[model samples]
Target: MELTVLGTGSAMPVPERVQAGYLLDDGDRSLLVDCGSGVLGRLSGTGTGYEGVSTVLLTHHHLDHVADLMPLLKARWLAGEEHLEVIGPSGTKSLVDGLLDVYEYLDGRVDLAVREVSPARSFSAGGFEVAARETRHSMPCHAYRFSPPGSDRDPTDGPLTLSGDSEAFAGLAAFADGSDVLVHDCAFPDGTDVSNHPTPTALGEVLAGVDVETLLLSHLYPHTGGREREMEESVRTAGFDGEVRVAEDGLRVDI
Candidate 1:
């Protein structure tokens, strides 16, 4: 399995980073975890064109997280790939309809299917056994854990988790308790008390007991610039003895 960071910025745009997005590829299978602003272009930068992505797993309906949703669907259509499977939170279907409504010309140009997922449930999609759990965010958000289909390996062994925007909470930690790679939201550095987002101090406490092979801190803000080492050390101070790395756009990891 390979993981690629398409974009690493939060809602606040930074020249150095784009919005939140990622791509998970396992040989012939590919799953796009999010389609935020500038993601389509970053997808191309990863050398995996838009046509190769047929499944998109959206965490929430935030603009920064879905600004390019319609553009991606249309790009695929232009590339002769008309079918897409979009799974997201409750209002996903409605959001798709609303997005397509704006671009009336592309309404029926592509075969887009949307699934609104429920928290604390497991489902199958695109060769993945996915588990979804609700997170403590201002809006409805779901953190996802993805494993290869039909393999009963322990969750700690290989399942990769994407922790959507949330404050450090036990529910989210439990969802990602034993993951191979946890791409968590590290919106800012420590001493920042913004709600519904995790700083290193807060996330360190959350990950203290979780057994993750690699902690990939993502969903960064401009404030996180030049503070990567501090973030890693904070988590380490909390007793998480795992490899911690900050996520950057176009970062590709093969596992």
Candidate 2:
């Protein structure tokens, strides 16, 4: 699986980084994760017009992570595209229905499907086998694990776990343990005194004992400036031997 970080900034979008969003592709098909306000523009910047997104999976109903849902759908609809699939946490169907109600134009322009997901359940979106897990956070957020078909116990094609905005908690290890890559929210720098969202030091402890291949930190705040190296070193001190790195907009990774 490969991932494209569309936007890595948090609730307040920075000039260079928009809100939270990403594009996941496995050569044959592509899926979107989080559609922040500027996602479509970012997709255009990637040089691939929004023509064939296999599906969209939202972490929660938070506006920063979902602001671009209608925009993406409208753009695709106007271009004569149809059959869009969207999956999300328990309130996903109602969220979409509310949006559709507000934007009446969305009613007949596209054939959209919605699936409200729960933790520990498995589903297939496009060609990916997906699993969901609830996380400790302010909103009804979740962490998702994505796996492609025809894979072994080996991590060469192991799951990619995306930990939506969450506080550092024990529940995360099971979702991240022995995974290929962990894209977690390291919203604050170490010793930054935070809760309900993770600081690098706090979140690192949860991942310390996990058997993941790489740690790609995202959902960064502007205050996290210039502490990338320090954060990686802290996670290492927590016992994570795998590679660790900060996620920047437009960065891509494959495993």
Candidate 3:
């Protein structure tokens, strides 16, 4: 499986990064997670244009997470793609309905199916098995863990987990306990008063005992600029001794 980071910025936009978006491709199909602003444009760079992504799994309805959703639907429709499936938390249906209601012209332009999934549920998307866990965010957000077809049989096999947007907590760390890559929302650096998103130290503290192969910090804000090394060091000092990486837009990792 290959994972591509589309956008790494948070709600507050930064020129170098976009918003929240990631593409998980399992050769057969592609699954898009969180189509925030600038994400649709970033997809074009992945060789999997909007039409190539038939299913989009969202973490929440926050603007930075779902901003480009309508644009994606319309792009697919314009490209003559027939079907699109959207999966997300409880309010997913309403969110889609509301978008279509406002953009009435795009209604009925494509075969759209929206599924509302609850936390702790497991589902299949893009030929991969996905497990969802609730995140400790201001809104009802969900972190997702993705594993290729039979990886479940081998607990040590590589799987990818995304924290969506949340504070660093034991539950979230445990949920990503065995992932090969945990792309968490380390939105700020140390010494920043923040909530609902983790700082490097806070994230590393919870991840101390987790057995993830790589902790890829993502969802960065402008404040994190020029301090990437410091952030990594803070995480290391807090006790996580695994490989640490800061996400960059368009960076791709194979698992």
- The lowest-lDDT stretch of 10 consecutive residues in candidate 1 is 149-158
What is the TM-score of candidate 2? Answer: 0.93
Cα lDDT tens digits, model 3, 3-67, are 99999998897888999999988777899999999999999887788879999999999999999
For residue 14, model 2's alpha carbon misses the true position, in angstroms, by 0.9
Per-prediction count of colliding residue pairs? 0, 0, 0
Error of 3 at 211 (Å): 0.4
> Model 3 — which ten-residue stretch has the worst lDDT?
149-158
What is the TM-score of candidate 3? 0.96
Task: List the lowest-lDDT window of 10 residues for candidate 2.
Answer: 149-158
Over 4 Å off in model 1, which ranges?
149-158
Q: What value does the lDDT take at residue 34 in candidate 3?
A: 97
Candidate 1 on 105-195: residue-level lDDT in tens?
A: 8888888788888864577666777878888899999888888655686433447998889888887887787787899998989888699
Backbone clash tally (model 1): 0
Q: Write the per-residue lDDT of candidate 2 for residues 59-87, one digit (tens) a residue.
A: 99889898989988888888889878888
* Comparing 1 and 3 on lDDT, the stronger one: 3
